[model samples]
Each structure stands twice: as C-alpha cells, then as structure tokens.
Target: MEKEEYLDLYYQMVLIRRVEEAAAQLYQQGKIGGFLHLYIGQEAVSTGLISARQPQDRVITAYRDHGVAINCGIPAKKVMAELLGKTTGVSKGKGGSMHMADVSKNFWGGHAIVGAHLPLAAGLALGDQYLENDAITICMFGDGATNIGYFHEALNLSKVWNLPVLWVCENNRYGMGTAVERASAVSEIRQKAEGYCIPNDCVDGMDVLKVRQAAEEAIRFVRQNNSPFFLEIETYRFRGHSMGDPERYRKPEEVKKWEENDPIGIYRNHLIAKQIASEEELDLLDEKATKETAEAVQFAETSPEPPPEALFEHVYADVS
Candidate 1:
C-alpha cells in the first residue's frame, strides 16, 4: 500500500483506541451513563473494514458501535456527546452509546438487540438492489449474535434474493461470559455462512492490513455478483463484555497472550519495519489522537442535555 494509506490506517486505529480509552475513563467517573461496551482490542477490525467501504455503502452493527460510527466519518465529538446523552449527539441524545445513528453518513445504526440488525442490514441491501444502485451494505456483529436465529434467517434471505451485503463477524471468542466452545456447536463462525451459499473467509483480526485485504475482496465480491459475502475476523476483546463484568470465564494468561498481539502495537512495528514511518512519527500520531479525544470529551461535557418535552418528538413518525 501507499505511504499515505498506511499512515491513514495507523492514525485512525490510534484515534479509535484513544477514544475508547477516554470513554472508559468517562464512564468510570460517572460522566457517561448506560451500559458501555469498550472496543479497545477490536480496533483493527472496524478501522480497516469500515475504511474500505464506498461512499454510498451503508454499515450496521450490534451494540459495540462507537468505533464503527467513527470509522464511517461521524465526528468523535458527536459520538462522545451521544455517549453522554447530550442533545448535540447524532441521535439527538436519544440513542446514547448503544444506538448511535448517522443517516447522513449512511451509518444505519447501532442496534441494541443481539442479532436484530441482521435483517435490517439485509433490507438495506435489498433496497439498494431493487433501486438498481451499486451501493452495498456491511453488517457487523459479534460471535454471540451468530447463534441467534435472525442471523441465519437474514443470511438465507440475502442469498436467495442475491442482495449486495457483507456479513462481518467479529469473533472475539466469548459471548457475554461464555466462551465460543461453551456457546457454539461449531466454533468456526465462518463455516456457518456455508449453509446460505455465501462465500466466506477468516482473517487475523489483529492485523489491519489483512483485514483491509479481506474487506476489499468481500466488498468486491458482493458488488460484482450482487450477492452476500461473509468474513469472520478472529479477534479478542481486552475488556470484559461490559464495564462491570467480572470476567471469570477466561484466565489472565490468555488475556496477556492476546495483549502481546495488540493490533496498534503490531501495526506500529510494521510501519517502522517497512520504513514507511518512524517511531517518532507514530508517537506523534498517537499524541494527535489523544489530543483530539480530549477535545471530544470537552465537547461532550459542554453539550446540552435533551429536554424532557423533546422525548416525544422522535418517538413516533409522521406518516403524513
């Protein structure tokens, strides 16, 4: 890849890491309420794949969505504001952390239900297909969502109709507190797509370049053939399922092992090895991300809270 592309990927990954870290701090300090899911270790998955999407392509995902929205071009301040339930948020502070939606950016939403967004993703693809548009839809979900019935139904429907969609499974090995072995009959999540006749591949989720390559191929396949494709990225979450999770299911050694393969560190080393960037340059990039994240926090803190009367505004739609 070109130098600028490498720099862009690295920068975005750093931005996401900083943003999540800031969010965690804010949540602990009681500045942000709600069940916060931190995307600390899964940075490469969203950064690489979402960055590969076209302008008209739409993205939908389960509750772990701040990273996806950021990668889709939603301002970091707006995401932070939404997390803080500020009126300036993307969802007008209504969606909070688990329900950020930027229709203008084509980021459909961060659906709170386990596997519910899968069908909505298919519907988006179907609409594009019916309109004869070349745009595609990318649906991202965790391994836990795969076990849900909607996952299978959506994939089957997409396959039958030949809708342009990409199903991306961020297999982080545990669903809530249950390990994949304990939860899934077949631990290899990519194999599930075979039942729906969708071509699928598994990539090292810790590697940004690898994820980007797989994303490019998946996007190409869906767009060219007007069909669905699946990608199961083997990654791990450094944090618990949620902020208060006791995390008794996995050992500390396992977490340590994965931390050694940390995506940001790996990519930083790759850039240095390729002579594309220096350690100093990368550090500067990290500083930039940190600065930006602090600014986002400031923006969120000062943003106004939604009024009580405003609650009924978006609750219902005007059919007329």
Candidate 2:
C-alpha cells in the first residue's frame, strides 16, 4: 500500500474517534437524542473492513452505525447533522442516530432492532445474484445479535442459497450489558456460522491493517465462491452501552487494559515503525481530524430542523 493509503486509514480512524467524542459531549448537552452509541474503541473494525469493500458492495449493520456510515462515505458533517435531527442529515434528519442510510452509497441502514438486518443482508445479496452483478452485501452486528433467531435463519438461507454476503460479527464481548459467555450458548461466534456451514474466521479487530488483510481474503473468498463468509472480529467497546448506561457490569481495570491496545495508538506506532509516516505528519493529521470534527458539529448545530410537513414525507412511499 502507498503511504497515502496508510495515512487515509489513519485519518479516518482519527476522524471517527474525534467525531464520536464530540458526539458524546453533544449527547450530554442534549443536542442529540435517541440512543447514542459511540464507536470509540472499535473504530478499526469498520474502517478496515469497509476500506476493503468494492463500491458496488452493499453495507448494512445494527444500530451502532455511526462509524459504519462514515466508512461508507457519509461525511462527518452529515452524520452530525443527522444526530442533531437537522434536515441536511444523511437520512434527512428522520433516522436520527440509529437509522442513517444513503442508498446512493449502497449503505442500507442503521437497523434499531437487534439481529433484524441479517435477513435484509441476505435479501440484498440475492438481489445482486439475480442481477448477475459482481456485487456483495456486508452485514455487521454485535455478539448479542447472534443469539437472536434471525441470526440463525439468515445464516441458514445464506449458506443454502450460496448468497454473496459477508456476515461480520463485531464481537465486542458483550450484548448490551451481558457478557458473551453469560448469554451466548457458544462464546465463539464463528461456531454459529459452523452450524449453518458458512465459511468463517476470527481476527484481531484492534489492528486496522490485520483487519483489512483478513477482510480482503474473506471478501475475495465470498466474491470468488459467491457464498457467505463469517468473520468474528474480536473487539471491545471502551464506552458504556449508551450515553445513559450506568455500566456496573465491568471493571475499570479491564477497560484500562484494553485501552493500552488502543487502535489509533497501535496504527500510529505501525506507521512510524514501517517508515510510512513521521510523528510530525501524524500529529498534523490528528489536529486536522479535531478541526474537522469541530466543523461538523458547527454545521450540525447551524443546520435547519426538518420542516413540520417532513413528518409525513418519508413515512410512506409516494407511488403516484
């Protein structure tokens, strides 16, 4: 990869971190509403995975989707606007934090219901197959979603029909407040894929390059075989489940330990070690991300709210 590509990845990860940090502040100030889930520690998973996708490939994921939307090319300004319910938002202020989608980018949505989007992903892959397009669908969800019945049905049909889909499980070790081992029948999420006979692998989600490599291989396998591939990305979310979460389930020491493996720090060290970038160059990128995040917040704060009539606009399709 060129130095430019490495830096772009670094910038994006930084941007996501900065944006989510600003979002957390906004949520506290009541500038944003609904459930606010920050992609603080798990930035590398979406950044690397989406970076590996072809534009024709569709991406759909669970409600924890701000990072996913940014990865799919939704600008930080638009994402922030959506959070503030501004009309300029990607979903035109209708979807809020959990429903941002831009079909033009082939990003399906931010589904609020747990595990509901899995079947939707299968449907998307089937569409690509029907059109005979060399496209695929990438479905992302949490470890908790794997416990849902939809997870089982979707994986089964995807395998049986050989749908071109990548089922990415961002196993952050928890489903909301419950630890994976406490709730899931099998702690290793890929085993569920095994039940459905889908090809699967697990990788470190904290490292961006490793994720990108694994994703390239997994994506290549799906594209070549025209079948579903499951990836259990081992990750941890440093923040609480939501802005309002009391977070009594875990220890502070555990979070500090994971924080030692911070994705941004890891990638920054990698770039320096590989002679891909200098400390000064990376520092500039960090400052740039912070500025961009501030500008996005300003844009969202100044953007207009949806007009009163907008409530009736996207609620139903206008067939006429």
Candidate 3:
C-alpha cells in the first residue's frame, strides 16, 4: 500500500474507535440506551474488510455492529442519534444499537440475533449472482456464533450454490463472557469449515494490514470461483461485553496480554517504521477524530426526537 492508503486506513480506524468511545460515554450519561455494545478493540477487522468492498456490495454482521456501520460510511451523528432513540437516528429511532442500517450504501444492518444474519447474507449473495452483479456479501460474526447451527447451514448452502460471500468470524476469544474453548467442541474455528469443502484461513484480526490482505485475497478468490470462503479473524475486545456486565469472566492479566498486541499501536509503529507517517501526523489525526466525535455528539444532542405519530409510519403497508 502507498503512504496515502496507509494514512487513510489509519484515519478510518481512528474514526471508528473515537465514534465507539463517544457512544459508550453517551450510554453512560443516559443519552443512549438499550443493549449498547461497544466495539473498542475490534475496529481493525471491520475497517479493513469494509475498505475492500465496492459501494454496491453489502455487509451484514452480529450485534457488535457500530464499527461496521461507521466504517461503511454511516454518519456518526446519525448513528449516535439512532442509539439515543431520537427521530434523527439511522433507523428513525426504532433499531437502537443493534439494528443500524443504511441501504443506500448497501450496509444491510446490525442484527442482534446470534446467527440469523448468516442465511440473510447468503440470500443476498444469491441475489447478486442472479443479477450478474459482481458484488460480494461480507458476513461477519463473533466466535460465539460459530457454535450455532445456522452458521454451518448457511456456509454449506453458499458453498454448494457457488454464492459470492465471505463468512468472517471475528474470534474475539469470548462470546459474551463464555470463551470459545468453553463453548465449542474444537477451539480452532477455521478448521470447522473443512467438513463442508469450503476454503478457509485464519488472520490476525488486530493487524489492519494483515486483515486487509486476507480479505483482499478471499474476495479475489470468491470473485474468481464465485464460491463462499471462510476466514476466522482472531481478535479481542477491550471493553466489557456490554454496558451491563461486570466482566469477571476473565483475569485482568489476560486482558493486559491482549492489549500488548493493540491493533492501533501496531499499525502506527508500522507506518512510522516504514516512513509512511510521523508521530506528529498520527497525533494530528487523533485530534481530528476526537473533534469529529465531539461534533457528532453535539449533533445527536440537538436533534429532535421522533414524533409520536411517526410510530404508525414505515410499519404495515398502507392499503388505500
């Protein structure tokens, strides 16, 4: 990647991180509500993968979705307002934190149900293939969802039907406090794909370049073969599973150990070592991101709440 490309990727990651941090603060302050899941440490996975997609391509994921929406070009203020249940929200205040969708950009949603989105993504791929549009559907999920039967079913069908989709598992060690080791028969998530004859690989989710490279290769393979592929991105989440948990499931040292591989820090060092950017330039980017987040909060704060009468709209179709 060129220096400019690296800088853009860094900027996107910073934007996601800052937007999520601001969302956490809003939830704490009672401005945002209803099952808030912060994507503090998993920004690289979404940012890198989404960067490789075309505008017409679609993205669907599990509940930890703020980063995906932001990376896919949803305005920060709109997302914040959606979380706050305000009229100006992305889903018009109906979807909250887990159901952000911007169809104009082909960002399907932030589905909350564990593995429900997988089949929906497969259907999306089918649509693309039927229409002969070379677009791909990127389905992302957590390690916890890997154990669910829907994932396997979706993969098998997509592979057999030669659907253009990439099943990306963000293996963040724990699935709402239950570690993958405790939840699954075998801890190696990618290896599970061999049974279905789907091509599979693992990538370091924390490293943006690695994630990008892996996604690019998978996307290319899917385009060439018009088949499904599987990727397990081993990542970590720094914050508690949600706003409610005390997070007593893991030891502090474990969290610290993962922090040692902080994606942001690693990428920053790589840029500097490669002479792509200097510390000062990165700091400026941080400052800019902080400011942008602050502005989004202000916008959400001032935005009007949805009108009570609007509740009847966008529901059942009008029958004349």
Candidate 4:
C-alpha cells in the first residue's frame, strides 16, 4: 500500500476508535440505549477486512458491530445516529446498536443472535452464485459463536455446495464474560474447520496489515475456487461485552498486557518509523477524527426521532 493508503487506513481506525469511545460515553449519559457494544480494541480487524472487499461484496456480522458498519462505508453521523435512535440513523433508528444495516453499501444487518448470521451469509453467497455474480459474502462473528450449532451447519453446507463466502472469527478471547477455555472443547478456532474441509488460517487481528494480507488471501481463494474459507483473527477487546457488563471474567492485568499491542498506536508508530507519515500529520488526523465524531454526536442529538406510525413500514415485505 502507498503512503496515502496507509494514511487513509490510519484515519479510519482513529475515527472508529473515537466513535466507539463517544458511543460508550453516550450510553453512560443515557443518550444511547439498548446494548451498547464498543469496538474499542478491535478496530484494525474491521478496517483491514472491509477495506479488502469489493463494492459488490456483501458483509455481515454479529453484534459489537459499530466498527464494521463504519468501515464498510456507513457514515459516522448515520451510525452514531443509529446508536442514538434518531430517524436519520442508518436503519432509521429502529435497529439501534445491535441491528444497524445499510443495504446500499452491501452491509447486511448486524445480527443480535450469536452465530445466526452464518446461515444468512451462506444464503447470500448462494444467491450471488445463482445470479452468476462474482460477489462474495463475508460473515464475521466472534469466537463465542464458533461453538454454536449454526456455525457448524453453515460451514458444512458451504463446503457441500462450494459457496463463495469467508467465515471470519474475531476471537477476542472471551465470549460475553466466559473465557474460551471454559466454553469450547477445542480452543483453536481455525482448527474447527478441519472436519468440514474448508481452507482456513489465523491472522493477528490487532495488526491491520496482517489482517488485510490474510483477508486478501482468503478472498482470493474464494474467488478463484468459488469455495468457502475460514479465518480466525486472534484479538482482544478492551471493553466489556456490553455497557453494563460486570466484567468479572478477566483481570485488569491481562487487559493491560493486550493494551500494549494497541492496534492504532502500533500502526501510527509504524507509519512514522517508515516515513509514511509524520507524527504531526498523524496528530492532525486524530484531531480531524475527533472533530468528526463530535459532529456525528451533534447530528444524532439534533436529528428527529422515528415516528410511531412509521414502525410498520419495514416490518414486512409486500409479497404481491
């Protein structure tokens, strides 16, 4: 990637971090409600993988999805508005934090249920293949989702039919307060694909370049073979599973250890060390992202709420 590309990636990561921070604050202030999941430490994974996708490709994921939506080209103002439950939000405020979607951007809805979107992603890939389109479906989920029945079922059918999809497991070590060891028989998520015969690999989710490289390779494999692929991105989440989480599952020291690998900070240093950008330039980018996040909050604050009568509009499709 060129210096300009690196800078853009840095800008996006910074913007996402700021936006998630702001969302957490808003949730505390009662400005946003209903399951505020912050993507504080997982910014690089979303930015890298989403940046690797074509415009025609479709993306889906479980909750903890604000970064995914933003990286997939949803505007900060709209995403924040969605979190704030304003009519101007990406889903017109009906979806809130866990259900934001922008079909025009090809971001399929963010699923609140664990591992439920796996089959949906397969359906999308099947549709794409049926239509003879070259578009692939990227389904992202957390490590917790791996143990679920849908996870295995989707992978099985994806292999059986040779669907074009990428199953990305963002393994953040814990699945809603329970450690991976306590929940799964096999802790290595990529190894779960062995029975299904899907090509699989693991990537460092904290490093944007590594994540992008791995994503590109998986994407290429899917495109070339028109088959499914799986990637387990080993990462950590700085925040709790949700806003009100007691967080008794992990120690502060463990979090601190992972914080040392802070993705944005590490990438910023890389840029400066390689002469891709100056510290001053990076500082300016941070300032810009902060300003944009503030503006998004203001927009969400000023935007109108959805009308009660509008509730039924998207509830059902007209079969006629």
The lDDT of each candidate is 0.93, 0.95, 0.89, 0.94
- Candidate 2's TM-score: 0.99
- The full ranking of all candidates by TM-score, starting with the best, is 2, 4, 1, 3
lDDT of 1 by residue, 40-61 (tens): 8999999999878999999999
- State which candidate, 2 or 3, has the greater lDDT: 2
Order of models, best lDDT first: 2, 4, 1, 3
Give the lowest summed-lDDT range of ten residues in model 3.
311-320
| Model 2 poorest ten-residue lDDT run | 311-320
Q: Please write out the lDDT profile of model 4 over residues 36-92, one tens digit for every residue.
A: 888999999989998999999999999888999999999999999999899999999
Q: Please report the TM-score between candidate 1 and the true structure.
A: 0.98
Candidate 2 clash pair list? none
Residue 300 CA displacement from its true place in model 3, Å: 0.3
Candidate 4 positional error at 313, Å: 1.9
**Stronger candidate by lDDT (1 vs 2):** 2
Write one digit per residue (lDDT tens) for candidate 2, span 117-210: 9999999999999999999999999999999999999999999999999999999998999999999989988999999889899999999999
After aligning candidate 4 to the native by TM-score, how far in Å is the CA of 123 from where it should be? 0.3
